[model samples]
Target: MKAAPAAQQELLRLQALDTRLAQLAHRLNALPQTAPLAELATRDDAVRRSRAEAVGVLEDAKTELGRIESDVRIVEARIARDGERLTQTSSLKDVQALEGELVSLKRRLSDLEDQELVVMEKVEGAEGAVAAIDDERAAIAVAQQSLEAERDEASAGIATEREQTDRDRAVVAATIPADLLAFYEQRRVRGGGVGAALLRQRTCGGCTITLTGSDLEAVRRAAPDDVVQCPECDRILVRTDESGI
Candidate 1:
């Protein structure tokens, strides 16, 4: 293949742009925020689960407290009815039985009140736990949002750079002959994004292999306009003054 020396040099510039573009793409995919965002997601899920459990416990405590209060009300009503009977009764035995029932009702009320207190304490503790979890979740949310913003900013910068690189690549590619450009594109796809390299110090820069004897002679004998290919990697070898023919 034959291309002007200027065009050959353009290939080097194209390769550099392509390499930078690849690096930018890699950086975009491996954004620093990705790992932390994933970790936050896991933590958020755990916190939510904990909050839900606390809510369940609190609700149960409330229900138990309500039942205890209801029972206490019933016992108080019974004591009031028995006390009225004692005031109305003429028989001594009936009065004694009513007094004994009143005492029992008082004991039952005390027990229900004690249970209510315990349940109320549990409810309070559960509420506190939920509040704490909510606070933690809110903090995590703020961190996640900040990280997302940073990731977006980094992505926007990379996108702007890529747009400029694309424009430069288009201009450089257009200056080369159509056939040569097409050949370079084909090699770039096949050679893992590298199509050309400098032949410096008798070494194939593409594959870092030193050419000797006949291989060296062939490259040295080639015209300046001739497109030499690396014998090891088959990439176009763009020769320059430092080529060490």
Candidate 2:
């Protein structure tokens, strides 16, 4: 004997629910761990900060180096002028003072050159730090790409499954009587998309409310193919083999 349209509609709703549940479960299972993405983001931020710091250091060192080099050049020029003045000076005191000034300028130039060397070394160290940070960022990018690919693959499978389920739903819906479909849709809108439910153990599957003995007897007396609604939630109730009642 063919089941009533109400029972068929309930079966469709169950299938739809199961499909939705399965899709959700698949997505939940496929999701990446939050910790790994968070950790990667942290590393990326740190690398960016380090690179910025390195650039600042390098710029400062270069500026200092330039300043020191300029000072050295100025001292050398002053020494040359003093040397020419000493050779031309006939006065004894002026010659001695000029010689002292030249010696001081030479010593200052040497100190400036040493400072420039120190600045250059710091600049090199800063550049190396920048390079290291860049490499780390590159590695992080590769890992991110791999993770994205995995997520896409997992999502694709779920999409395919959902498409197949939708096709099956369409097929099942086409066989349903229009009047029954309209009734189911109306009830479903009010009952959270569950218009019909199975009768399990004398309880309403829609509300899980147990039926009284009299109500149970009444349901039992109904035609086998008749569509009946639950007294509580008004959802069409279908009897199944698993119905404890």
Candidate 3:
């Protein structure tokens, strides 16, 4: 393929734009927040499970406390009724029977009150467990929010750079001959995003292999306007004063 020397050099500019675009894409995917965000997600899942277990414990403790409270109320009510009967009864036997029942009911109330105290402590402990889990969850949320913000800011900057680089690439590509540009585009796909490279100091810049013997002679015999490819990596070789051919 034949292209003006100036037009061939334009490939170097086009290649630079394409390389910058590729780097920006890679930066977007591998942002510093990406790994940390994934780790935060995993920690969040564990926290969610812990919170669920803590809530279940809290509910059980509350249910036990409720039962103890109800029992204490019933015993207190019985003691109050027996004390009233003892005061109102005129018969000694009735008074004695009411007194005995009052004593029993009071003892039962004391036992129920003790149980209530123990269960209340358990309820407090359960509540603390739930609260601790909540604090951890909140901390994770804050971290995730920060990371997301960082990712967004970094991604936005990379996106802007890529957009501008794309525009520059379009302009550079437009200055090349149609056939040459087409060939370069094909080479880019085949050469890992590098369509053209400067053959500096007898080295094929695309593959870093120094041309020798037959390969060196071929490039030397080619006209300045004749487009050439690096035999090693199949990329268009853009020659300049530093080519050392």
Model 1 TM-score, all chains together: 0.69
Candidate with better lDDT, 1 vs 2? 1
- lDDT at 206 for candidate 3? 88
- The TM-score that candidate 2 achieves is 0.64
Where model 2 places Cα greater than 4 Å from the true spot, the runs are 1-11, 14-18, 21-29, 32-38, 84-94, 163-197, 201-245
Q: Weakest 10 consecutive residues, lDDT, candidate 3?
A: 80-89
The regions of model 3 sitting more than 4 angstroms off are 1-7, 25-42, 71-111, 140-159, 174-186, 221-227
lDDT of 3 at 3: 92
What tens-digit string does per-residue lDDT give for candidate 2 at 92-201? 99999998898898888888888888888988988888888889899998987777777777667777777777776676666777667677678877887678787888
Instruction: Give the candidates in order of lDDT, highest first.
Output: 3, 1, 2
Judging by lDDT, tell me the better candidate of 2 and 3.
Answer: 3
Q: What is the C-alpha RMSD of each candidate to the true structure, in Å?
A: 4.2, 5.4, 4.2
**Per-model TM-score versus the true fold:** 0.69, 0.64, 0.70
Q: What is the lDDT of residue 241 in candidate 2?
A: 66
Which residue pairs in candidate 2 have backbone atoms (N, alpha carbon, C) closer than 3 angstroms, thus clashing? Answer: 201-244
- The lDDT leader among the candidates is 3
